[model samples]
Target: MEKTVMIDGKQVQFKSNGATPLKYKMQFRKDFFAEILKLHKLGKLKNLDEIDDDVLGTLDFEVFYNIAWTFAKTADSSLPDPETWLESFNEFPIFDFISELQEMIMANIQSKKK
Candidate 1:
């Protein structure tokens, strides 16, 4: 899956594919699926408002940045290291777009049942 989202007034590209998890593991040194499981509740919520404060409080928020950067890096190889790339942006509203990123992640892992 591929998408372009606006961040800090710039259009940034992101992609998720078979290699995305490998790339994430290489870059972040953490298992992609494990990190994703941390946010599993978000996957089931219909909206941010549906998230309980207790659940939100328990989430490892850094995973959001890691996953976002991984997808961004996968889409554009020339993007600098994650921190530097993120520094270039004045703001990155990960919450505003995490659902989209999660969809891409889920698509890469889910299989169709027939």
Candidate 2:
């Protein structure tokens, strides 16, 4: 499944292949968890003992940037590297884009469950 949303005033399409390779999926999860752990170590995230989805969703721009860049790279290789791509933006709509992408991912998962 694929959907396009505006990010930094540019149209960016996020693609999800139901058949995504396990390696990429694993890497995404690994990196995500690592970021969370790093944040906890830095005392950036509250409740070190347990983090709920609500807390995860409230992560700052750094985490959002990493996830978004990873997702974008998986979706499109033709795009520039994360640093270059990020540099292109004067202001990033991180939360808005993440929300849209998250919805798209959930919708894709739901479709596949059938």
Candidate 3:
């Protein structure tokens, strides 16, 4: 899959097992974060009541979490704070997928703020 976005000062550079270009991947990821951030800034991004194809779309939570994990791992190398996720363990009873995602996004923003 293409990881198109700039998580930190650096662009998303992870290469998934696909025949996609690095630039394309980064651009897609960049757009994803941009949208997520925009919605977040508007305070519209929230946890969905449920996890279904209509909710998360074709994007599986596993894939999304993995990407977030990569960013957290890399960001943690330089950032030192709980605000930024850097890394997170799998928790159960996460009723809403968006809640977890929102947390991740918040952590990313919080990390940037500091």
TM-scores, all models, native as reference: 0.87, 0.55, 0.29
Taken over the whole model, the C-alpha lDDT of each candidate is 0.84, 0.57, 0.38
Please say which candidate is ahead in TM-score: 1 or 2.
1
**All candidates: CA RMSD (Å):** 1.8, 7.4, 12.4
lDDT of candidate 2 over 1-114, digit per residue (tens): 676778778887666564333423464455444454433322333234454667666655565566566566667878776688789888885545555666544443344443
> What does the lDDT read for residue 36 in candidate 2?
41
Residues 47-112 of candidate 1: C-alpha lDDT, one tens digit per residue: 667779888887787887888889999999999998899899888876677767777988866789
Please identify which of the two predictions, 1 or 2, would achieve the higher lDDT against the true structure.
1
lDDT for model 2, on a 0 to 1 scale? 0.57
Worst ten in a row by lDDT for model 3: 15-24
Best by TM-score: 1
- Residue 67, candidate 2: alpha-carbon lDDT: 53
Candidate 1 has what TM-score?
A: 0.87
Pick the winner on TM-score between candidates 2 and 3: 2
TM-score ranking of the models = 1, 2, 3
